[model samples]
Target: MKKFTQYVFCITILLSCKKIGTPELQPINLKISTVYASTELGKKLSLSKVLIKILNVNTNVEKQLITDANGNVSFQGISAGVYDISATITIPAATYSSVTGEIVDKDVIFNASDKNKTIGLTNNELNIKLVSGNIGNWLIKQIYYAGSNTTTGAGYRDQFIEIYNNTDSVMYADSLYFAEIIGRQSYTNTSYYTLPNGQMDWSKSLNMPSNIDANNNYVYPRALFMLPGKGKEHPVLPGASIVIAQTAINHKSPFTGTDGKTITVRDPSLTIDLSGADFEAYYAPFLPRPLTSDIDNPSIPNLNVLAYNGTDMLFDNPGRTAFIIFKRDGTEVKDYPKYNYPTISTPSSTSDKFYQIPNSVIIDAVEIQPNTASDRVPKKLGASLDAGYTFAPNGQYSSQSVIRKTDRTENGRKILKDTNNSTEDFDYFSLANPRGFK
Candidate 1:
């Protein structure tokens, strides 16, 4: 009977231990502090009411909180795990202009992010520095790189880019230069020059200036074109946009090609009518024999082809490309130095050269990659220019385009979102829209 009693006691102890299991994980009390960038104007700006987002990396759970007047927020009793914290705030244009003495017609966005942060017993505090982005008057509203069906649709010939004036005043398109930023297109590591992040290292190029930063301060352009206008010539009204087309012809309707043959699309719905495009890229004058569809539009003005690549202004249909628009401050683009690729061995004297553009003059930029993550190459632009890249989910020849999201409407003026993070600011359109908003 004593043995039976002891067995029951032992079973009871085992069950109690099982119920207790391991001691519950101790939750952490995390504190986050937000600060402005290290600038005179930034120091004077207020940091209160900034939205803070904390994403638990392990659990895939997210929480949001607003910062106090002192720019501090505390997360009490939170699970101890890795997290990604981000802060975003928008400053009114009047407030920014008054503080900085800079004229801005639209609101300014500031963003800060700290990734892979751990909240444990020893580490429970984090500080995020918010950096202001370009108080953009013009923005790349849409990019239609992915064309429609190759056999039944317009293919790559319908690709175009739309730029919008996001301000409330008139803005000139005069002498505005846009280019296709060049970078490593594949992931294959080569003995040739490469940046630590797997991008092409232009500093190793022959005759590259030793005085200036070749990779960080400047970007190389595979193709460069500029709008032909004097100051105040092409005035884009508030909320208006300008579309630049590869061919300014109506793809929905049959058109006469440069080859004197008719060009038509089997699926008109898959394409867009670019006949109303403000500017068209005419490469026939520069190329010995341009594409048969590269016909000139007498009604549409042509972009000044400062540099040429391929046969036309053809974008990589699978994404794997980037674009930037900037205005000349003092120096002429023609005077800018060009250099060959950074080859292990010296390139030939007649090797092709690409023009280098300074980042200081860049007004806006967008980085793109293939729809699938496996096919994506290393990012070309830095975080300041574009924190994250965007892509069309349907991949190439899918008639898709990435368009900027509308943040809010102020007095009937549409303000597009510009967080410097394309992944969050952009959404893909199943069919490309020239002046459409999401």
Candidate 2:
């Protein structure tokens, strides 16, 4: 009897050890739902066949599944951990136009993402609402904020941005405006005015109109420039792109700086030749002491600078900035009000002011943050404009760039992805490419 009791104790101990070795995993049941910007179209949209992806944040393991006719999907025996869930669906143009009475030449993509979600031992049903975004005809194709090597490459002088005509028809670039979005760059100062997300609370700025929803409805610009063209003067054909450079010159070869000095790169291959750039930013006239590299190319047109910042059109090399493109609307941008930072309770007469641009007029926007997650600031663009942000994975001075992904080619025309989520819609190029497709 004593031996039998000892044997039972040993079996119980082994069973306990086995349970500890393999903890019970939980199941995740997800429901996919469609949310239309137009409520009328919501009733007509279908929810089945949506692709859902769940990523284990800790393990980087991803699982993909499709929703059934009832918009239901399940993942059994998933380890409890932090996860990121995303869903995407494409609706045919004909179907979308027929349901909404809107005409679109290409399919519309709807995307949704829930980040840093925790799934514990308790299983629960989560509903993901897919949102359709504004289909933009002219989109920001690529951004080269990560300039070349400081010692061996062109440095910030090689930075450029490309804009593409995403539609099949010709779109004139007349009076189209683009700007470098400005916001609070730090997160440590709690005494300053900030939004719930820790972004600058522009509504708190002195002399800011109280009637308007400044925080959500508008964005401030550090620099604003307009593409030079009369109506139909600058026709961008379908699948074509225009490159805008800081200095329109061949960076691969030695060039004469504005200071009458020679500037050369140790490695020409690390930089690109922008002599053929369609437009360049000339800031010498605006700055008291302009950067020597801010040379102008007479052949290439200069963007009309409405608002200037820094000594030149230099992007933040550390990738702490956002950009947006819009067109002239009923209200003139020059007439828009400017205000000082909200942190200043009393502003002097000569305080620097930032131009407030209405979100309704913005055509496209992309938010960029530091490659290191800990240094990231609050999102400047809202979810409606850009649900996610992207950056050059290699960081500053790496000659890398964030380029939009190609969704598919229809009739040999490249249709770049524009799901209002840069993280999902963009990919990085090891080197910056002007007028190049990914």
TM-score of each: 0.78, 0.82
lDDT of 2 by residue, 1-438 (tens): 999999999999999988886654435454434354445666778778888888776676988888777566787667777676777778999998998788888788777766556676563457666666677989999999999998999999999999999998999887899999988787886645897667888888988888999987889989899998878888899999999899999999998887799999999999998999989999988788888888889999999999987887888878878999998678888998898888746767888899989888889999898887556677787656776778999999999999999999999999998988888889999999898888
- The per-model lDDT (C-alpha) reads 0.85, 0.84
Clash pairs, model 1 backbone: none
lDDT over C-alpha atoms for residue 217 of model 2: 83
Maximum-TM-score candidate = 2
Q: Cα lDDT for residue 70, model 1? A: 85
Top candidate when judged by lDDT against the true structure: 1
List model 1 lDDT by residue over 327-408, tens digit each.
Answer: 9989999998899989888899998899988888989999897876557676787656775678899999998999999988
Clashes of 1: 0
lDDT of 1: 0.85
Deviation in Å, model 2, residue 365 alpha carbon: 1.7
